[model samples]
Target: MQLLIVTAHPETQSFNFAMRERAATVAARVGAGLSFSDLYQQGFAPTPGRADFQDFPATQSFDLAQAQKAHQQHGGFALDIQAEQEKLEQADAVILQFPLWWGGYPAVLKGWIERVLSYGFAYGRDKTLPAKKVLLAVTTGGIADEQDAQRSQARLQAMADDVFGYMGWRILGLHLVHGPADLDAEQRAEALNSYAERLRLWLSEAVPLAA
Candidate 1:
């Protein structure tokens, strides 16, 4: 099985990165072919624009869908975006690991999605990429209370239904690790261990997507 882990944490020692490392270990244990994209380390561009295309005319108004379709047909995607698309095409499962920045994905990851998953690629095509499993492994500082937790859950569910679901990917799981900033060392370690076990179980099982 091919597995791709895309991590969008700037700090190497951050809790999110630790979780990503745990995921890497689990992928290795499962004997899956693995690939990784450390966006921060690679200095990935978070803004999508004309640079993404090589064949589009400079004077043409940037219509994202039109430009993407044209560029894809002509092999005009920038090197980075093309490489990422290639990786996605080969993956059976994709793990997105990032810290919740201001209640959403980090900008780098958001950009990666916007740029790499282009029209005629991840969507707008007859096939809509390929059927695969997606796991969102997110780390958050803390949720203030039950209301905050509910809000977060709603937002994540919307993403699962609207964003990934619309693109034809299956939502395998949404794993949220909370209180990473406030937790003590032992508590944090325990949380990581628990998450790792959950990941292991998920990897070992063949659970179907929810309707």
Candidate 2:
């Protein structure tokens, strides 16, 4: 099995980093080929526009979707965008890891999707990418039961439904690690171990780790 993990966080030493590493460990145990895209480390461009397109006319109005569609036909998306698309195309499952920023995906991750998941590739075709499972593994600013965490989970689920679900992919699960940064060393390790166990089920065993 092939698993693709995309992480968006600025600090290399942050808990989000550890989270992805924990995921990798599970991927390894499960014997899945792991593909990682660390946005900041890649210096990925977060904006989508004419620069990302190849054949679109500069003089014409730039419609993001139309431009993406054009690239699907003419084949001119930037190298970085193409690389990310390739990873997603190969993944049997995908995990998006990042902190819950403003109750949504970090702009970098959102832009990565926008620039990479082009038209016809993400939708508007008979067989886009095969139906793969997607998991939303996010870190929260507070405990999961906090009002904010509840709302964030709802919003993230809605996003998964509209984006991945609409693309015909299954939503595997959403793992929320609350206040990871605030945890003591022992607590943090315990949380990571718990996450690893869940990852073991989700990525390796193809089972949803019940919340």
Candidate 3:
């Protein structure tokens, strides 16, 4: 299996990064080809602009769809965006690892989605990306409670129904690791281990797309 892990955390030693490392290790153990994009470490640009396209006219009003389509047709996307597109195309599964900030994706990650998953590559009238399994590994500092769990579930559902599902991707799992801020060292280790095992199990199984 080919797996692509995209991590958007800034601190390499944080729990989010630890989860990413564990994912890499598990991918190696399962003999899955692994590719990664460390958004913060790579200094990924989060804002989309004219710089993303080549030969885009200076006078015309910026139209994302038009720019993306023109750039894709003429091989005009920035190198970084092109590289990410290639990785996404080659992967059978994708894992998004990050700490949930304000109940949503980090700015850089959101930017990555906007720029790399462009018109004609990710979605368009005649072009939609092939279905692939996707997993969201979200970390939260707050303790898991009934209310928080409900909110998280709602958010995940929205993402599934509105984002990934709309884009023709299958949602395999939404793993949330909560209360890392209050856990002791042993508890934290156990939490990480349990999540890692869950991820391994999910990756080992064949999950059909939801109808």
RMSD of 2: 3.2
Candidate 3: worst-modelled 10 consecutive residues by lDDT? 202-211
Expressed as tens digits, the lDDT of each residue in 45-81 for candidate 2 is 9998898975667699988887787777768888888
Give the Å shift of residue 125 in candidate 2: 2.8
Off by over 4 Å in 2: 144-148, 207-211
For candidate 1, give the lDDT of residue 147: 93
lDDT of 3 by residue, 1-211 (tens): 8899999999998888889999888777777889999999999998998989766779989988788987777788888898898899889999999887887888999999889888887877765467679999988768557997879868866865676888888898888888677889998889889888888888887533222
Per-model CA lDDT versus the true structure? 0.84, 0.84, 0.84
All candidates: CA RMSD (Å) = 3.5, 3.2, 3.6
Clash totals, every prediction: 0, 0, 0
**Model 2: lDDT to the true structure:** 0.84
Count clashing pairs, candidate 2.
0
The predicted structure with the larger TM-score, 2 or 3, is: 3
- In candidate 1, stretches whose alpha carbon ends up further than 4 angstroms from where it belongs are 206-211
How does model 3 fare in lDDT? 0.84
